[model samples]
Target: MPTALTAPAAGAVPPDASPDVTGSDAALRRYLHGLPGVDAVGLEARAATLGTRSIKTSAKAYALDLAISMIDLTTLEGADTPGKVRSLCAKGANPDPTDRTTPRVAAICVYPDMVPVAREALAGTGIAVASVATAFPAGRAGLEVKLADTREAVAAGADEIDMVIDRGAFLAGRYLQVYEEIRAVREACARPDGSAAHLKVIFENGELATYDNIRRASWLAMLAGAHFIKTSTGKVAVNATLPNTLLMLEAVRDFRAATGRQVGVKPAGGIRTTKDALKYLVVVNETAGEDWLTPEWFRFGASSLLNDLLMQRQKLRTGSYSGPDYVTVD
Candidate 1:
């Protein structure tokens, strides 16, 4: 029986600080429980329909550029070193060194400790430095440790803080604990100037295992003040998929319609090729509309996908087949 904290109103200027939480555990649980259950068969069918869309050559070229810009060029490995982070930043700032026309990625995501290294590497570029916090990939730490992880990243100059929700709590039906953790992390994202670090809440939907849990987690994250609802940590067996991502898009769309606050979506892991990336764009285009097509509202959390995109771009321009040797692997 946890109590709701007073947070900033929904869609307020400062994304992090306080959340516009619904109510007590009972009320919030009741509200979430009452939301429409997902139709798995119908959802899969719709996703399949969207996946089959044929993008013209010209449109695909446009989508390739757009997809590159919307990437949260990520490196979240335990073996991640400063050299590795700098290399990733270089690639993110300029994917194709040969072509100056190539747009930079939206941001460079790294571990909290490496925020400074990434920040230094990406300095003066419009590309942002994002850090994964909340004992990332596990979300098993206590709330204080999680908040400290987030605060340290922000203090180290991370422009964005990607936090993981306590899936254990959510799965156990302790929704209030999960909700309060997001609210607290949102508060930690606040800067001294009244601005807040952008917060992206990761549900690790692979671990959640069902479309219904994914939908519920999506709403919970949005309601508790997530600036973006990310699909996975890219660490589990079942990372981002077409159906799961499509369901997330639907959640963001419905949330915006219901509350007038727009939240972004990021689909990470297993989206390795240009075709898979384009299918996601199609989902965003049709489900969330053109407004969400921009990087401000959409992102792909990937590492190898960029190299593939660069190779494809080269082929599109040179009118010849390209190989892995043509692109730099970050």
Candidate 2:
């Protein structure tokens, strides 16, 4: 059995109001089960309503730049090489080499083994190196191996850790086990200064398969110590839809209302164009509100999305559309 870390008192909300869901497994489970359930049709309808927002001219330009800055330019694949990571980092550092006005992306997300390569490549550029850990895309490994994965990334200077939750456990009614894994990964993210690398917990909502499960997983992750609650690993088929992302936005927004500590939201997978990215911004704007607009609070996990944004950005500046050949293949 995994030994328990000293958790906060049960049902105790500290004066700071940070989420204090750490307690006996039974207590935590009760708390999670007691939370209200989600209404799928209502939720999807609301998301569709938010998606109808129209952005234009200067507003479009601002939204475009904001979207660019909020991107977690990603390259998560078995085929990832050092040279590929280096190239990705450079693109993230200075997205538009021809136009200096282009803002750098929020971070460069990669596998644990590639953290050092990305860290070195993005050095002094204020761009963070984020690594996917805890048996990313699938959280099927033992606790020890998962922690080692997180520690290796942190040791390699990963400014952020994106850890996936154990979907199988959650589905099997092992909620406490899922929460405990997130808590353990959170502990592993700690740095020398007592501060820790930002932890983004991927819920794998596609697998969770219901609005209720996504909502439960969001609160569960936040309670366990997720600084950011993400939508997917981008490896699954139903990756990041407008309705799903909106649901997560609502989760973070409500979690803040209940606990003073704010959490971020990242919608990974299949968000390919500037239009799709903008609609998500509309969800954040209309749902999570303006406060969630910054990179610190929200992110889009994508690689090809960057090139699309660049093409659109060029059209905005040059008054002409640019083809795929004009942008870097990263």
Query: What TM-score, to 2 decimals, does candidate 2 have?
Result: 0.93
Deviation of model 1 at 69, angstroms: 0.2
Candidate topping TM-score:
1
Off by over 4 Å in 1: 1-19
How displaced is residue 109 in candidate 1, in Å?
0.5
| Candidate 1: Cα lDDT at 236 | 91
TM-score of model 1 vs. true structure: 0.94
Clashing pairs in 1: none
Where in model 2 is the C-alpha error above 4 Å? 1-18
Per residue, candidate 2 scores C-alpha lDDT tens digits across 208-247 of 9888788778888887889999999999898899988888
